[model samples]
Target: MNAVTELLAGWMPGQRWFGGKGREWADVTAEGFLLDQSDPVLSVHRVRVTYKDGATETYLVPLSWRESPVEELSSAFIGAVADPHGGENYAYDAMRDRDATVPWLTHLVAASTVGPMRFHPAGVAYIPEGLPGDILSTEQSNTSLVYGETAILKLFRRLEPGLNPDVEVHDALRQTENPHIAPLLGYVEIDNGPGEEASTVAMLQAFVPNASDGWRLATSSVRDLYAEGDLHADEVGGDFAGESERLGEATASVHRDLTRVLPTEPAERDWYRSLAEQMTSRLEAALAVVPDLAEHADGLRRLYAAVADTDEPVVRQRVHGDLHLGQVLRTASGWIVLDFEGEPARPLAARRELDTPLRDVAGMLRSFDYAARHMLVEQPGDPQRSYRAQEWAERNRQAFWAGYSAASDLQLSAGSALLRAFEADKAVYECVYEARNRPHWLMIPLSSLSRLTSLV
Candidate 1:
């Protein structure tokens, strides 16, 4: 490995956006090109890592090179590399460096091409030019920069072939004028080869200022209910059922627009069997990682079997693969959905595939459960709090279902076998994820599984 590659192998694993944490690296290589030649040079590097299991992944790493170490950027500093001329040059993660962020918007405004990277504007909104961006710290799989609250740029860290689903979905929704979606301002793409499809590098969208995310709003409501000893969820001043209903309506509107623009097909009988098999396979995998999942395995398989045996008529369409409270913003006007890329860990082809909108509904239902019970993680064994949490979740879940059914004119209930199966499948995914990332939170999904599996 070269000096920079060696440094990256050490630094990249520590980053929040790095996907390969526990895996052993068999080889690591990098190639970089200069994006801007200003005072503090900005360069974007593609770091390719090959694991012992023969899996390969490429990550986009933007670094700002400086002649001397800046004390202010000590936290973002990567090890110094030997300068081509003589001495050493200090490198820092460019997303955190204010000086390095200016070139992104500048190039987008000019619609310029920097090496293989191309910036294309949608012409629907004005691109904010000459403004440095401030990075948002909440993201895990990608990094986002807010430019003067006018626009936000999401940099895709993990590089894959073809256009990203988030960009594709937003670009398709542009002409629809869907109030639930934020307008796509521009996007960045990189050339793959002579005949290969270009890969999406980043996407820019209009930023919603002074908007609170659904997670925060829902959790605050949970807190309010906890404070009131006797008040029900609906009677609480900070009840979230109304917001949940509005969010459901917004979700249905986006789903309708997606169906209008994207492809949709009637699901065949074989599709249900395939879906059940997939969920069962995922549960089997989760059992390996989380031993606690073994006890629920037989019951979970029974749920999946019910899905396979069901004869429900369904139409598959492009829906948000990953939908939860964190992926939504509660603006003054209404709820705005964000991040249609789905689960970052899943393959791109799977994320782009058409599926039932009920999957999205199931995802939201799971989110409501999470919002209600997340507070109980720390204070376990409290029956009163646990009962209140269940009450809050059920109320909001029903309200959301009512709003969705009203808007879509589809009378699907929470008791549907397919919805139950999808929710259980999502819970299984969460079990593996929480076991790997946050062990303390593993109980949240495990408890959900217990209830889901108990249902006849």
Candidate 2:
């Protein structure tokens, strides 16, 4: 019932991470609890939000506000705060607010037991000095709190009717409810919905702290092996063979659990048709800019064609649509997949659709390329970087794919060809993605697609 004039509203849609910023938000009613009473009111509050457009949606946005934010606030997970001059201003992701993020974690734990919804307890997280904000380098479905030393808590901005897979999966894993993924202490949700009141707004779980992303971890391992002109990742301290094998097996275990949680239905061809159409738009739009892909346009179309018409039998179930290096955590315990929320450009309906497990596999493979190239970007002209990237992608992609396929009982429609199509789709998507978002990072995907020689 509080009528707080959010001056930073307009500034939100401009952000890569602010999922609802592009549309008009009508009726901004607010509710939340303040984590800190002093120093700018660190409140774990949200905007009972709405969006205006043809395909309309409503969501919950966690807002972190202060009387004023410190300089470089985004680095601290500050999203937006009011400007002194009465204009809209952004801070960082709310999860970066230590006062808010840490308290939010403990709050979820307490609420799990005390709240009407009893969440299974998993691990505990305490903010250490220099805890990092969620990876801000890209536009992701949700923002997170990454403790440089410990755990991560994903602050969910968008709301869905059902319990978020993140909360469900993590809690299951934490309670020894399942073992394929990372642990979850539980999650935080409000009691305010139909059938279920107050949906999940955020999740607090064990952070796989200190783990490099799988892509990064793999490259580090490959660097050690590739320097010796070998394709194996078993030579270095960061040897990826074991990790990759485990990640593959881990992904399989996740699918097993998913099959248990989600009911299997007949594979719907219409879903694939619509998906192909959407990808067509993205691919066509990308072709206009990156002429290099013009020749591949037909290849692209032929690729997506498989989505709808592949003769191969299909199995439908939920999957991590945007699995990649950044989405995975390579902890001492093992590799952990994250951010079930799919590609930002995709609508929730489409992203939530059950598709080929290979789609997730494709995403991870593409990420292997990004991880390798990113390492090269750092050292620039480091001979070892090139060799290392390919070796790592080669070794781990094989392991990841082998493990996932074996576990999921999947037989890809075109095997390597479908993989190429996905790569083309992912690369084209990344190209436009980099062009608009990180123009400098355009080379990452462009280079990846360009060098995509036909995989034998």
Candidate 3:
């Protein structure tokens, strides 16, 4: 192994964006590179790694190489490495190097084409020039850089060799003049090679200023309701039912736009059965990991079975594969959806699969339950607080459904069985996730399973 590859093997396992966490690295190799010849060279390298379990993943690593260490970027410093030109240089993540990143922004603004990469603005009248930039401090699955307050560019960390749905859906929504989503300002695409499909490396979108995360808003509302000693959820001054309803409407509107621009298919009987089977498989897998769920297994099975027995065909479209509160932003105008990339862990084909929009609805409903119950995890002994949490979740859930049904053709309220099945499936997925990642929070979803099954 070379100096850089050897250093990355140790560093990759600790990164939040690295997919191979908790796994032993069997091998790491540099697959491709895009290098800029300069004093502090800017390089984009694709690293392919194989784990001990025989699984493989590819990640994009952008680095800046300099002769001297940068004191301000000490935390980002990778290690000193011998340069091919017969000198030693220090390397750091290129995103933190303002000078190196400036050229990338310039390329986008000028709509420049270099080698196999294309940097062009889409659906925007003009590109802002010479704007100051900063990297967002919040850690995420991808790296994001904000150019002033006008736009944010998200660089995908894991390199998938196909069309990224975030760019795809945003471009389509921009075409329909959809206002509920951030307008796609521009994107960077690269041609892999002859006969290989081009990949979207990064995307730029209009940054919604003064926006609050949907998760924070919902949780804060729940906290307000819990604080009011004698008042019910609706009677409280910080009621989130109105905002939840608006969010539902926005979600439905985005779904309509996606259906209009993308190819959709009817959810026939065979598709329904396949979905139910997938749910059943997921539940069974969760049961193996979380034995506590075994008690509610039968109740969950009934809900999934009900969906398989339904003969009515539902409309399937390119809905958001993952639609939790964290994926939305509430601005002064309205709720704006972000990140159409779907579930990051799932394969590209599965994430892009056409499914009933209710799946997204179920995801949001589960998010509401999470937002309500998460605050009460530490105060478990208080029955009154738990009751209030449930009350808040139910009220907001109903209001959301009402707003969604009013705006869309589907009468989601009438399809309680399907909705319950989707919710149950989501909770099962959560149960597994919590069991593996956050064991203490496992009770939140376990309690949800009890409530959902008891209702059925």
RMSD of each: 1.4, 6.2, 1.7
Residue 142 miss distance in model 3 (angstroms): 0.9
Which of candidates 1 and 2 reaches a greater lDDT? 1
Could you say which candidate leads in lDDT?
1
lDDT of 1 at 183: 94
Candidate 3 per-residue lDDT over residues 1-456, each given as its tens digit:
887888777677787888777778788897445556665688777788988889888888888888988898888888888878998899888877766666666778778777677887884655555674578887577988887778888988887778899988998888798889989888987777888887778888888889999999999999899889899999999999999999999998999889889988877788888888999999988888999999999999888888899765588889888999999999999999999999989987687778888889999999999999997878988999999999999999988888788888665565578888888898999999999999989989999899788866
Which residue segments of model 2 deviate by more than 4 Å? 1-6, 10-16, 19-45, 48-152, 159-162, 171-176, 191-198, 222-239, 375-392, 412-417, 438-456
Candidate 3's displacement at residue 388, Å, is 0.3
Candidate 3 TM-score, true structure as reference: 0.96
lDDT of 1 by residue, 272-376 (tens): 999999999998888889999998999999999999899777888888899999999988899999999998999888899989999999999999999999988
lDDT of 1: 0.92
Residue 295, candidate 3: Cα error in Å is: 0.7
Backbone clashes for every candidate come to 0, 19, 0
RMSD of 3: 1.7
Question: What TM-score does candidate 1 reach?
Answer: 0.97
- Worst ten in a row by lDDT for model 3: 31-40
Off by over 4 Å in 3: 32-35, 84-87
Q: Model 2 compared with the native: what TM-score? A: 0.72
